[model samples]
Target: MTVFDLPARLDATNAPAIEQQLLRLIQTDKPALLVCNFAATDYISSAGLRILLLAAKTLRQQGAELQLRQMQPAVADVFRLAGLHGVLNIQN
Candidate 1:
């Protein structure tokens, strides 16, 4: 299992950077499972959601699983509002 700790905020300003880093991890490390730890993440925007969706898709294609964990209420709500709570593999 490989875990990536996300920043407090995931938005348009930094989603691309995070995406690149995650892609590198997926390509180089090739972990069977990837966990995006949102314990410290308080906010996430549409761009962030886009990145997560992309990551999930890429990981799936690689035969790896992506799990979103420890999401703060606000961030979780964002996912809920975006209807991603069902699309993404999220855990409390």
Candidate 2:
């Protein structure tokens, strides 16, 4: 498993760069599990959600898993509001 600590804010400004980095990690390392720690993330915009979904899809295609953990309530709520909580693996 590979654990990635996310930034405090996930918005359009940085989502693209983060997406590239995440994709690179998935393609190069190909870990069985990729854990994205959202302990420090207080906000997640739609762009951020898109990145997560894309990463999850890429991992799924490779037969791996994407696990999101330690999310702040606000960030978690964003996922819930987007109806993504059921689609992704999220842990307290």
Candidate 3:
């Protein structure tokens, strides 16, 4: 299992870094657990959710897993509203 420290802001400005990190994590040979912390972020835009959705897809392909933990409510709402709560496993 590996932990990922999400940026303070994960909007349009950080999309590239997020995508790169997601790819890097997927390259691992073993099944992985990616714990993402979004507490530093007050809110996330659709762009941020887009990145997470992509990461979830990658994790599925690799037979690994990704989770959102230590997330603030404002940000969690992003996932909920997107109907992603059932898709992404979140732990707090």
Which one wins on lDDT? 2
Badly placed stretches (over 4 Å) of model 2 are: none
Clash pairs detected, candidate 2: none
lDDT of 2 by residue, 1-92 (tens): 99988999999999999999999999999999999999999999999999999999999999999999999998989999999989999999
Question: lDDT of candidate 3?
Answer: 0.81
What would the per-residue lDDT of candidate 1 be over residues 18-72, giving only the tens digit for each residue? 9999999999999889999999999899999998899899999999899999999
**Top TM-score prediction, candidate number:** 2
In angstroms, give how far residue 4 of model 1 lies from its true place: 0.0
Candidate 1 has a TM-score of 0.97
lDDT of each: 0.93, 0.95, 0.81
Candidate 2, which ten residues in sequence have the lowest lDDT sum?
72-81
Error of 2 at 49 (Å): 0.1
Ranking the candidates on lDDT from highest down gives 2, 1, 3
